[model samples]
Target: MSHPWFARPRPRVLAHRGLLPADADGIAENSFAAVAAAHAAGAAYVESDCHLTSDGEVVLFHDADLSRVTGDPRPVAEVPLVELERLMGARGGLITLRQALEAFPDLRFNLDVKAQAAAVPVGRIVARHAERVLLASFSDARRRTALDAAERFGRGIRPATSAGTATIGRTLSALAVRSMPLVRRALAGVDALQVPERQGRVRVVTPRLIEAAHACGVEVHVWTVNDAPHMTRLLDLGVDGIVTDRADVALRLVAERR
Candidate 1:
């Protein structure tokens, strides 16, 4: 059975780190404002990263440190929730994992577990809203840990998850050899394969990869594509989703195609 996260129509526009409004200057990615902007732009899916604060609270943040976003050289894990909230408040708006899920009841989320400490908490938090969330991470171990935690902590329901880096590598290797069995094995249990169209010079999301993923009942989503032409090409190539910083543009493109 398809998870509810995939119930929405294909060619999904996953707002990368939420969507920063064109006129909303200083609003950081993953902030409340960015998420709200995505919602306002008619994005059904919002892709954001997760990290654990010093007080063990789960927050929506991208980088390991606050240097780029806040000009503070402190690590996110070393800052308390109150302090983090204060900093984010001035930049845009602060939002906890629980708060975001509660606030956006109708929007689906693609959450990347960035911190090791946040894996279990993310699982626990999304357990209640399992149908509407898809968990992802570069580390397969961290991703699996969260999946297990979700099952252990909440209602015995495991939320949808995407392939991790290792899994993607194995799947690509299988595809290189035209091994459908190997490809299916590599994609087993994952609902989506979120990847860059290329890793350096090597092309990753070819027609074969998309076909193999579909064979395994997995959806292919290309990441960080912001331009309209690239978005149109990927959608033409039958990609299931596009993760983009410009949700407004992507949404318009998808609508035109429909």
Candidate 2:
């Protein structure tokens, strides 16, 4: 299902949070409806963050605590997956890593591992879909551990360096950055470099950045893009992938340009 060379959809669209609230669907983030919308919208890949529950089930959730989404101020890990499911009844339903895999059946997934404790269990969950799942994290160290476990479990891991609203890749390389060595090592273990689009008032995702990451055999995926002009700019600059809220817009933009 996860074909690395599946013609690489033109400026591949990764529907963010399943195209939630942004569209007519009132489906909240981290809910099943959101995922469905993302896939239905023709997103080739769907990205979501996952956290562990008390019963050790790897449940799909974006935030670490229930305070924001659930309106309860409890840590998700402290609640058993069952209880969480009970709270998130049939409206959305709690989905385990297994459920996600079985339900989607080949959708390429990028999972953000929220905690180090999640490493082993998350690794085990994604392993079943090795050919299709890619694990990403802010913590290179945590990503390394997850990748190791994923390898043992048979899933391929992808190294990531999020630009966090800061445009990255405008610079040719991280050669001058303090964490270059660590990033290089992390890049060696994975296939892609995930980053943001803005950096200190200077757009970082320039051709040089794409060239640099590609030179190291790392594909670049830019995230959270919500506008068309910016999308066009990145594509012209040769970005490998674009994660956005408007998959429809991305698809339309590419089609119009073509």
Candidate 1 structure lDDT: 0.94
**Residue-by-residue lDDT tens digits, candidate 1, 1-258:** 899899999889999999988898899999999999999889999999999999999999999999999999999999999999999987788889999999999999999999999999999899999989999999999999999888888775679999999999999999999999999899999999999999999999999999999988999999989999999999999999999999999999999998
Most accurate candidate by TM-score: 1
lDDT of 2 by residue, 153-196 (tens): 76353323232111232222454463545445535545666777
* Among all candidates shown, the one with the greatest lDDT: 1
Superposition error at 158 for model 2 (Å): 9.0
Backbone clash count, each prediction separately: 0, 8
Candidate 1 ranges with C-alpha deviation above 4 Å: none
**Candidate 2 least-lDDT 10 residues:** 163-172
Give candidates' CA RMSD values in order: 0.7, 4.2
lDDT for model 2, please: 0.69
